[model samples]
Target: MNDALPREIHAVLIPVGSVRLLLPNAIVAEIAPLSGLEKVERAPAWLLGRMPWRDDTIPLVSFSLLTDANAQEDVRTARVAVLKTLADDDEMPHIGLLAHGLPRLITITPDLLVRTDGGERLARGTSAHVLVRSDQAIIPDLHWIEARIAQALPA
Candidate 1:
C-alpha cells in the first residue's frame, strides 16, 4: 500500500579518461575549456597543476591518475570541471577536475541507479561503482579527494 513517488536527483556525468564519474549537479560549478596551468613543483603526478578560475587559482587534478597511480592520459585537450569544495576551508574554496569533454546532465531516480560493485574492490577516491540506467559510472569520494588535494597543494 506504499504509494510514494521516487525522488529524483539531478546529476552530472563527467568523462574522465575512460571512466565516467557521477556527481550531484549542485557541486559542479562550471565546465570550462582547459586553459594554461601553472605548474606546482614537487606535487604528486595526480595533481596536474593550478588553473586560473574566476579570480582565484585552484588546483586541477586528474581523476584517472588519482584512482590509478599508473594511469597516463594526455591532458592537452582536456576540459576543466570546477567543483565547489565541501570542506570549510577559506583558503581553498574550489578545485578543478580534468574532464575529457563536456559533462552530460541526467536525472536519477531510486530505481534508475543500481549498485554494480558486486563485492569488488572500489578504486581509491571512489565511493561506489554503480550502473545508472544503461551506463556504468563511478561515484567519486569528494571528501577524500578534497583532502588529498589540500595535502598536495603548496603552503
Candidate 2:
C-alpha cells in the first residue's frame, strides 16, 4: 500500500433542522449555544438575527429557508455554528449557522466522498450535494451565502 496519501480531513456534521451540513473543521470557529438574538429589520427570512460572537455581531442564518423547509426547533435548545467567512470582505468576517443540536466531529477521506443525484442543481447557498457515509448532505456555498448577506445588510 502506498503511504503518500494526505491525512484524512476532520469535519463537523451539523444538523440544520432536517438537513445536515458538512463543514471543514478548520472553517468552523466555534459551536456556541443560542441566546437572545438581536433581530434585524427588513431582513430576509433566512437572516434569523445577529448574535454576539467574538466581540462582533454575526448574522445567524437558517438552512431551511434556503430549501423551503421547516426545521426550526425550540429556541431555548438551539445552537449556532460559527463559521469563518470565505469572502474577501472584512466587514463580515464570520457568520453563524443555526444548528438544531450539537455538532459531531468526523474524519473523512477522499474516497468516502461521492456526488450523487446525477449532478443535482445547487440552489443559492448550496455548493455541492454529496453523500457522506450514506447520508446525504449539501456543502453550503459560503462565498455565495456571504455575498447574499453583504447585499442584505443595511446601509
Candidate 3:
C-alpha cells in the first residue's frame, strides 16, 4: 500500500437490513435523520427525493433499491448519509444517501479487510467485504450510485 493512503481509514459502518457497509469517513459530511423530504414526481423508485441540508437541497437515493433489494414500505425514520460528489467541472458537491438506520463509526485497517463475492445472490453495483465477525460491504463511489439512479430516471 502506498504511503499516500492512510493505513487505516476511519469508516462509518452502517447496517442495512442484513448486510453491513463501510463508508469512507472523508466524504461523509454528516448523518441526519429524514425531515421534510420533498418527493420528486416521476423520479426513479429508488430516489426518495430532495432534502434540505444547510443552504442546499440534495437528492436522496435509497440504498435498498441501489442494491436491487425490494422496496421497503415502512421507513418512517431514515438516516441520510450526506456525501460530496465532484461535479462535471470537478467541483465538490453534496448528496444524501437514504439508509435504514444509524451509522457506527470505526477505524478500519487494511490488514483487516477481506475481499468478498456476492455473486448471483446479489445484484450489480453491490460490493462486499469481511470485517471482524461480519461481512461488510460498501458502495465505493456515491456518484456512480447517483449516476445509476439518474440514468434510471425517465426523460
Best by TM-score: 1
| Clash totals, every prediction | 0, 0, 0
Q: Write the per-residue lDDT of candidate 3 for residues 74-116, one digit (tens) a residue.
A: 4576678888775552322677777677788877777777666
Tell me the lDDT of model 1 at 51.
Answer: 85
Which 10-residue window in model 1 sums to the lowest lDDT?
A: 69-78
Following a full C-alpha superposition, what root-mean-square deviation does model 1 have from the true structure? 2.9
Over all chains combined, what TM-score does candidate 2 have? 0.88
Name the top lDDT candidate: 1
lDDT of 1: 0.92
TM-score of each: 0.94, 0.88, 0.79
**Ten residues in sequence with the least summed lDDT for candidate 3:** 84-93
Pairs of residues clashing in candidate 2: none
In candidate 1, what are the lDDT values of residues 8-113, reduced to their tens digit?
Answer: 9999999999999999999999998878799899999999899899999999999999999789978878999999999988899999999997799999999999
Query: lDDT of each structure?
Result: 0.92, 0.83, 0.68
Error of 3 at 30 (Å): 0.4
Candidate 2 C-alpha lDDT tens digits along 3-41 = 886669899889887778899999999999887699989
What overall lDDT, based on C-alpha atoms, would model 3 receive against the true structure? 0.68
